[model samples]
Target: MKPRLPQLDRPVRMPSRSRILAAVIMLAVILGPFVGHLLGAGHGQAATPVEPLPLDSLLRQAEDQSPQVLRQLLLALVMSLCCTAIHLAVTVLVVVSYESHSLMAWASRTPLGRITLIAGTAMVTFLAMFVEILSWAALYLQQGAILPVEEALYFSSVTFASLGYGDITLDLPFRLLASLEALVGILMAGWSTALLVAVIQKCLALRFHRTDHGSDPTTATNP
Candidate 1:
């Protein structure tokens, strides 16, 4: 005869810290461009038919415009903070719902279910990054830095990926904003990678736990 382990009435909880950080990075990636747009709006239009300058010249130009650069940086910081806070709230709610439902445990019970869960998580994170890129694209269109929405989005995607294809280019002022967008993209992408890894690891741990207990005769009993 074997003793049965007690059934857990309470569901296991996912760690919230990593998810919260991922959400914050996602939000910052979107709002950083918006902040740049708002702050630079009053600065007037960037010179069209932009003259290509050497890297040193561009760096010098940015350095000379200390006040404007400072304002843009301040605005970006404020927006990032606000967006990060909002993301944290949303993440908390989502995590609470997921934990209460015992979704992870159910997913762990089956190989197909685990795969689906991991795939879904990856998709969600990818979508978040895509949406953030779209926001920057929209801002580019509004600011006249890019022509059509399609082109703007294409450029945004390229910049977000840090591909720097160099086909489409922005003027000096907006170039700074573009650079900022690229930075946000890098951070968000890294965060998403971390999130996906965490999710997969958690799922695998659950699966292994189930396997261990199922294999143990002491943990099971005849009805």
Candidate 2:
């Protein structure tokens, strides 16, 4: 009984090494685009500046030849991959930690702690996705094609979620990149939700055990 109870009451071990690795991965992902852009900009191809496309035309072009237009597309792809990797790593962290925390709290634990952590992590992930979307919108807008912040955000959310409402259709070339964002977003959201639920259930079970489970079933039994 003592051993089992103590085991259940132990705190989860944080993976310091994994977290450090995650940080490195995240940094690399973030830098991939800028690095790609620099490298792509200086490639051996002979370059001749040409008349810039008109706003609408450029926007269309950017949308269509996204790969050709921004050297960052490749970088963005790599960045997205990094984000995915970090996302997965963080997820594993939360799961392992939550389990450990639950085991430690044992009979006295409640779902509140786990809930808070899950919610916090999810919120951060949500923000990260939005930020990535905003970066793309800003890049395009810099090229003279403008979408309202609200509209861009909406499209971004939908894209990230992979809902593909089709209400605000991006140009053909842009669509491919957008799809990638959507896929990443969907996977991240799903993973976050699963971890959150698991933590919540564990927390709730502890609460139940301490409350209902500890109660005398016959306390209210008629004498």
Best candidate (score: TM-score)? 1
Q: What is the TM-score (0 to 1) of candidate 1?
A: 0.61
CA lDDT, every model vs. true structure: 0.71, 0.63
Which lDDT tens digits does candidate 1 get at residues 165-220?
99999986577778877777777777678767877876676677678775422133
TM-scores for the candidates: 0.61, 0.47
TM-score, prediction 2:
0.47
Model 2 whole-model lDDT (C-alpha atoms): 0.63
Per-residue lDDT of model 2, residues 1-223, tens digit only:
5555445566898879989999999999999999998887877333745676789997886688665536546745775776676666776766565445333353244455546655766676566656656665664455333357777767766777778788887764465567667776777678667766765665555555557776422232211
- The residue pairs found clashing in candidate 1 are none
Q: Mark the 10 consecutive residues where model 2 has the least summed lDDT.
A: 214-223
